[model samples]
Target: MRTSRALASPAPSPQEIGRAATLALHDELALSPKPGLVTLTDRGSHADMDAHTFMRSLFALRSYFVRIAELGAAQAPFEALEACGIAAEARMLAATQGINTHRGAIFMLGLLCASAGSLAARGLRPTVDGLRHTLTQRWGEALARRALRPSALPGGQAASRLGLRSASAEAALAFPTLFETAVPALRAARSRGLASGPARLDTLFATMAVLDDCNLAHRGGLAGLRFAQGCARDFIAAGGAGRPDGLAAAAALGAEFVARNLSPGGAADTLAAACWLDRLG
Candidate 1:
């Protein structure tokens, strides 16, 4: 779907970028209380997670996201894969899923969130989808830029990156990568008759609404989503069951951001999570 609305105009300038980076660093340092394991309580109880633990998880997740924003700004192919020490995977995802680092980040994050929901599709520590997404977006964007131009990327590709380039081709939905990431879970929800079409719209709206309810400005509290997603990711890595309430909270907040940006059409993942949480609630 066409995104008539843009991502809330990116932080005004590089100064803002610096501030964001600083804040992100601060948040990660704060999560040191919870080290490796993230606990998600099933009943009306939560494992005692302290500030430090939370910060560590946040720090790890930050790398996953900043890499995304950076990829979005990339201009070449060689640099893309090398952006985060992940060039080969970018090529693989591109070949298999038509995803570059730009699109891959979204696809991967969505997959992580969805996998977290299931929690035990396998007993192994699940791959951190967000991390993979970051690697993909970095390289993909570099590749996209290379395809757009003919130049040595951060690294550069020998051959052109495009298999098909059509003026009529829809611009890839790489923005809001989570939309792509969340597609599988969204589809499963629909197949199980657990969701409404474009269900993510409601989830996005609901997310924004909840944030509004808590007096958290969308810009200010976006970190909360990052933090929460990190916590969820770590929990899954430790084989913890999904937290229905946490899932709902994340979806509701996601909806809020999309609704405010006027791109509610791309909320399939958010809504699907909301449906799952609602059912599990």
Candidate 2:
């Protein structure tokens, strides 16, 4: 699929990049019956956040993406780009009343947004491969250094405590999960003629099956993470969203996850990343 509606025009503006990113986020939040994650129809496994909270968070983050994209187009330093992320996190916190709604997205999708801007600056189309290449070629060293910096966030702390790879590590390596796993799964689903929503659910489950979700480990330890992975594997084994009972199977798995207090937040972030990349292509 083509990345843009108007490929004949010049590079996209910062506002255009930001709007695409925000809409991708909204689509992720709205995907219903997502196992062990928040969705428009229900809170899934989370009690502190709901669809409304996600909406508020998205509202607060609209301009942050644009500003970061502009910074990328200008070839700003990593610190300047990070500053935009910091401010965006503050806004997200304020909107969710300290609920930590979209912090992971702020990091992963924020970098992709910047990568898109960098592509535009070079007169390149914002294809998925282009975005990944721009991220590594333009900011690979900086991301490596950033990965070594100790994080104070709960997710970061949990990742360190458990010895799981940090999100920063993934970014430093150009997001193997997004590129190798989630995006491929999403494309496979769409290529099979699945609608956007079902395709996204399949992508989410595919991510959940493979991701070492720090959120699940944080909340339920290794056992919980394993259980989540097992459920995901079973869902996919049963044909994922392709089966007539696929959506129902997903909903049932979600109920089981909630009972165990297992929320695959990391997998959810990966789903959002896949959604963003899909929009780009």
Candidate 3:
């Protein structure tokens, strides 16, 4: 992570912050060898959607982040942010012809961009701490109330069935996994001189090892989720993407995930959020 000194420059405009969020989603899509997830080259575990589907969704959502950010800059109530997100999700579904390419990103990265806007409006540059603080301070109670409602989304329903933490729960807690796990893993890998691809790969695997990915559970059930986590843990135990054969190992893992029809979409969303935060600095 960059120091606060590095972040002392003028805060980015809402449009710039929104653009970074879109690019971060693109970055996640362009990353190859993602276990059980869509990439530019292949549809990992999903047959319904591919990289093109994701691109169209991203294009549709280009303005949404900015709108949400503007609302956040004004310190608008949580209802306003939720309404923006609901509309964005509709646009994403329309763009992908009802395919859910970026639903998770819509919620997670949208909130982050809004937090960034909040900081900028307050004449502060975005730091991880600042972003988290803004999000919680501005809408923590609303998020908690939102979490109490039964989720209708497939992933959230699956999480409920399995007694796993839903995405809303993570949000209400201010996305501990994004700040505590994914961002740190990405930064540590980069600080160790790893390239972007390897660093992201490391972060993905690290995230998978711990995240109770509802997508995986929805597709493959509890057993499948455990299997995926075990694979990720083993990958990290073997030095993650730092080893010479790391890419090959990741490719093999991707193949295995496909065969089992498991997708760690939650972890992928977290990785994209981490990428967006990295860009903010």
Candidate with top TM-score is 3
Report RMSD (Å) for each prediction in the order shown: 19.3, 2.6, 2.4
TM-score, prediction 1: 0.24
Report every candidate's CA lDDT.
0.31, 0.87, 0.92
Over 4 Å off, model 3: 1-8
Rank all candidate structures by their lDDT, best first, as comma-separated numbers: 3, 2, 1
lDDT of 1 at 106: 32
> Where is model 2 more than 4 Å wrong at Cα?
1-10
Model 3, 49-88: lDDT tens per residue? 9999999999999999999889889999999998999999
- Look at candidate 2 and tell me the lDDT of residue 163: 87
Over the stretch 1-281, how does candidate 1's per-residue lDDT look in tens digits? Answer: 65532242222222222234334223222221121212221101113333344344334434433443333333224343244424334443434343221222233332222233222222222223432343345344443453465434311121123222211111122323323334344444455553342233223333322221111112224453344344334443432222334444434433443333321111222333333223221
TM-score of predicted model 2? 0.95
Window of ten residues with lowest summed lDDT in model 1: 37-46
TM-score of each: 0.24, 0.95, 0.97
Clash tally, candidates in order: 37, 0, 0
